[model samples]
Target chain A: MATKSVKTAQRYAMVIDAKKCINCKACVVACKAENQVPLGVFRNWIDEETSGEYPHLRMSFDPEQCHHCADPSCVRVCPTGASWQREDGIVLVNEDDCIGCKYCIIACPYDARYHNPETHTVGKCTFCSHRVDRGELPACVETCPSKVRVFGDLNDPKSQLHQLLATRRYEVKNPQTGNGPQLYYLL
Target chain B: MREPVWEFLIVNYLFLGGLSAGLYFASALATWIQEDGRSAYPRIARWGALLAPWPVSLGSALLVLDLGKPMRFWKIFFHFRWRSPMSIGSWLLVAFTFLSLAYLWSWLEQDERQSLQARIPGKIRKRIPARVQRWLDLDASLWRRNLAMLGFPIAVGVGIYTGVLLGAVQARPFWNTNLVAQMFLFSALSSGTAALVVARLMDREPVELKEMRFLYSMDITLIVLELFIVLPYLIHGELSSLAVKEALAQVLGGPFTIVFWLFFMGIGLLLPLAIELYEFKPVILGKGTFHIQPRWALTAGGLVLFGGYMLRYIFVFAGQATGFR
Candidate 1:
């Protein structure tokens, strides 16, 4: 009889080299299209900042989405256990279970969650969880023109995400929260 | 881009929840008070018990209706996450409601019980034997006393939980303070007392002015305590982080300045406080008899209730508007 192998759980995360971002907003549009996110609302977006003055000015674009924190404030404040996380590190909203109290939205420091008018439930970036389960990249990761986002299993040493994180110096959006955000913005 | 998800419904719910908790405390205190030979505190206690259940029940209905999925509200009860203030709050509201109703039941005078029994259909009443009915009539006054003592802490918890709900969300620095809980507790007590005073003032039957004076005295003390908490809360915000300072600016000298200072502090608190003080100074100094006109009582009580409401409104709206960047 052939020996059976047990598969280890995945720790999915995103590493973004925002220095290459062209501010094209392709990821934002693609995320909406993939998620069927309602117009006037977004699951992800690009934040733009300008620094210096006159001839010495520089513009930077940071693609922003749910940080998928290990200690999610949203999950902590959710009364109905509707906002939860998978063991694989993907945070999600169970629309059926959500009472739409919106306390999760209030709890999140990043302002990552939004109230979905169509479903009358809270919504946020899911790391394209459905696609990730099928061995595909998230919509934002796949559609970025300049390859801004790298998505992979951090648990697997051989995975691009884990290798990049180990090799590169990166920073999280709000480290002060100590929420253990998974998204690493490469320096 | 985080809009205020909670609006008027939430504001009303907070105010009403605090009011209910305060009313229960008022009743419990009255129930336990040592009545002098001719003390009129029982009427105050009666008013408190009679009025406590309705606001919380109505407020709870509004709370459910405010939910995106009103029907799924029952799910909150099934999974009680102790860390979540919302979860704890749902359980608190449920516990408070049942206890308040039972407390009200216990407070029913013998004649009131007879009248309630008379309302029961004759067929149903006949089906229940006299012995069973007599056995059911265990000492309600004793039960009231026990329930009062038991429910006191829960009522205080409910009052504190209202503020803690917002305070737990550190994303909003304006509400992230121990002072919020303290201020809310004092305001709830004052509002609850004011509500009872209003009820008595508007009662069809005349209640003793002496009993009304007791409520006014309680309200005056509560208002002073509330002011102490509110002033420190503002100062604490100013002395904290940049985000907290900016959040407090909303009420201090920003958009909410006029409303906070003029309406909430001036008319709602100080004016009422001054009126009540004037009314009670004679008694406090042991120089003359306690006296207060009905119109003045109505005005003072109404303002206290209004101030309590505005406090919740400012905190909610201002907190939502300012969050960590």
Candidate 2:
């Protein structure tokens, strides 16, 4: 949709193809190792959904994390303004201002946020902004065994993410939330 | 099987916040009525004013304690965001507490000749300097009226904010209805009135029969009103999308069904409502003389308080039990 006449910041997005996922959970482990997420809580996870019965059964391993929506419910519900969004649409929590009331945990439709017992603040997936800032991929995107995840700027017409959106049929989780979530699941 | 972000502390805070709002509203009503030359319910104004602050103070403390970083609770006060219910609620609570305290002070500052002065210790009364005593004894009728008028909407806001705090969470379908706020407001009013009735009847002072009857009738109306709003709240949830329907099933026929039907609906609401209707029926029908029986009044009032708490408990836990999944 871009004419390339106006400059805009990179709008980061993720597209996952669950059909290729083997559910080895390497991405989950890598996310934890990179983010140091507290034990018993996760910044990213793999959920398994099975369908049919008997010999016709099929299962899908869906890896999930914060969508970092265009309009995030967690940001709207935060009382202290600790939860905020970047110009590039990456939602992050400022630990210094978070009182840890946990309202955002309840507000998240995807159950993405967790109370990090170690840091005593709400923690969630940030798309590994630290790595992205350094011209590197997120730990999860880099670690997936089957190449299940594609991460790039949706605003860049030349990027693989933009190309996928232009050519593929995909669905987003909980579209009813009206948060305009950026995570796309290729159908 | 995700953990709930809130627990018992939040339930208590919701209940107490609503109760304090209801109490303050009821007291403001009493203050306005007393201005009409009715002398029976002066004690209601005093009792409600005095008791309103305690529950809210304790509730706010519990809310802060429930936080992950309790010491950083003060950060909520640095700025206010109108779009955030928690931010609005925090400011509402602080404003209500101060108004409640000021409202209490107005009652206490009434002319020293009143019976309230007799309760003060003789030594403490004597120790006060003449100038301070004169100032303390000034007739604060105007201040009382103005404060009551100003505080009425604030109290209502506090009552509604408790429900809106949960209702604002779109992710939790169980609490995503506007009816929750309306139901909570009426429930708060009923519980506040019940509290005043219980305190007045249990005290050593002689209960004003007229005031007692007024409170009974009011509670009955409020209880019935609460029932109307609560049913709609349930029906609205059940009739929404599948996620909302499933979330509401937690109370409809799910694990919370027992407490929802038995404690809150039966004992908490219907039973107390039946008692008040029975007690007030005689007075309304004009068939025979009736007296305010302390025993029955206490029973009804206590049940209402219990029911109010149960409403918050069920909604809090059940709402958290389900989400967009």
Candidate 3:
């Protein structure tokens, strides 16, 4: 029942440039490679939205991942604490303890979680916890061609993500969900 | 928005929970009123109590099998997070099954006291250890009392928890209503009572009509209750999101129209109600054998059970037909 909030750690966050993303799906490919994500399941994905019929057609490619919300529903709904949070704000799934009940999958409002067919457990973007612990960037950030992705410690004032969040006009997805999503999109 | 994470097994599990819960509750009620010495309906109490625990244990087994890592399902017991309904349900189900078994054993053993124990030789009965007699005495003393104290709430919990399991999902708006728990409980009771009636009819040796005014009227009331909770939950459903509206439409007149209207509403709910209503106050014919028909009563009970299952099936499947998009 105790929380890990007592630890002094950097909270990681991501900011993506929607205008720069070409829907190339390079981030998706990189994520799968790094995580060994199964087919028909995704830790992160791109959602394409368009409106208007003819001349005024507007379109955007929205690259989405787990928000690692301040109040994560997946963590709360997980019966065995399989879905949990680190002090640094990254949400992680402990595959060993997961019962594959899909409670977390239903709880996630953003559809960020996926049931891993191979592991027989629910999984989501871990914010590349392995690489983060090794002082390396996530595979999506490392592999992005146009430098459209920025991932860093939000608590570190010097990090690009911190400066971008302060300087640029950005918005989080599904603000109405009230999870306080950490991932931001630069408008 | 995607393939449903819960499938038919989950539906079956829900049905079993409701059915078992209803039977236990009905058995308890039958025992409570049997003091008035109603011979026609005492069989319901006896068979219902005897049959309650098996389906519950079987349903729990299905739930474990549904979890792909069936071995890992043990984690649910070791890890009990209060916020998670599934976590609480794991333990609740175990408690329910154990207590229901005790209840069944105690009630069935009472019948043995007269028949089996009386046949035991006085010398042998005397030679039996005091400890053995005490254990046998528990059915009448401890378990029968425990059935009243613990059995009722545990049964209700099993009935409502199925609804809570799905209703807890905030992403699935169609099932997220507070009314879901009430609706499921009512359906469980209606179906459960029908199961009791069917079981009672099965034991009857006489082909002639029997006086079961209590069972028929009780079933009719329960059928009315099923409609009472279900109608508003279906009709004035709150459209919290566009996805919910799409999901609710499936039940109204969409992809699941025939199942919802024809099978569930018409045959399951309405027809059962109508048949039972006719049998509740049938017109007396020549010899009066044509008047109070046991077959009509049997049909009504069976139909109510069918409706109960269809209700669970539609709620789970249609709830997913439109999901978070």
Q: Is candidate 1 or 2 superior in DockQ? A: 2
The estimated TM-scores of all candidates read: 0.93, 0.93, 0.88
Cα DockQ of the candidate 1 complex: 0.77
What lDDT tens digits, residue by residue, belong to model 3 across residues B1-325?
6777888988999999889888888877766664444424456676778888988888999999888688998898898899998998888899989888777777765666557677889999999899987776555533464475678888899888988888887767788878898888888877888887787778745433442555666777877877887777766674446656666888777778899898899999999899877665553222333355668778888888898899889888887656556
lDDT, candidate 3, A1-187, per-residue tens: 8876664478989999989989999999999999999998998898999999899998988899898998887888888998899989999988888888888887887888887888888889999999999999999999999888999988888889999999999988766656788989998
Chain A TM-score for predicted structure 3: 0.93
Top model by DockQ, which number?
2
Quality class of the docking in candidate 3, CAPRI style: medium
Candidate 2 local lDDT, B167-271, one digit each (tens):
999988888877888888899889999999998887789898778877988899899999899888777777788988998899989989999999999999999
Indicate the fraction of true inter-chain contacts that candidate 3 also forms: 0.71
Which candidate, 1 or 3, would have the higher TM-score against the true structure? 1
User: Among all windows of ten consecutive residues in candidate 1 chain A, which has the lowest summed lDDT?
Assistant: A172-181
Two-way TM-score contest, 2 vs 3, winner: 2
The residue-level lDDT of candidate 3 at B308 comes to 87
Please give the C-alpha DockQ score of model 3. 0.64
Which one wins on TM-score? 2
Query: DockQ of all candidates, in order?
Result: 0.77, 0.81, 0.64
Candidate 1: which docking quality band? medium
Candidate that would win on lDDT: 2
> Candidate 3, overall lDDT?
0.81
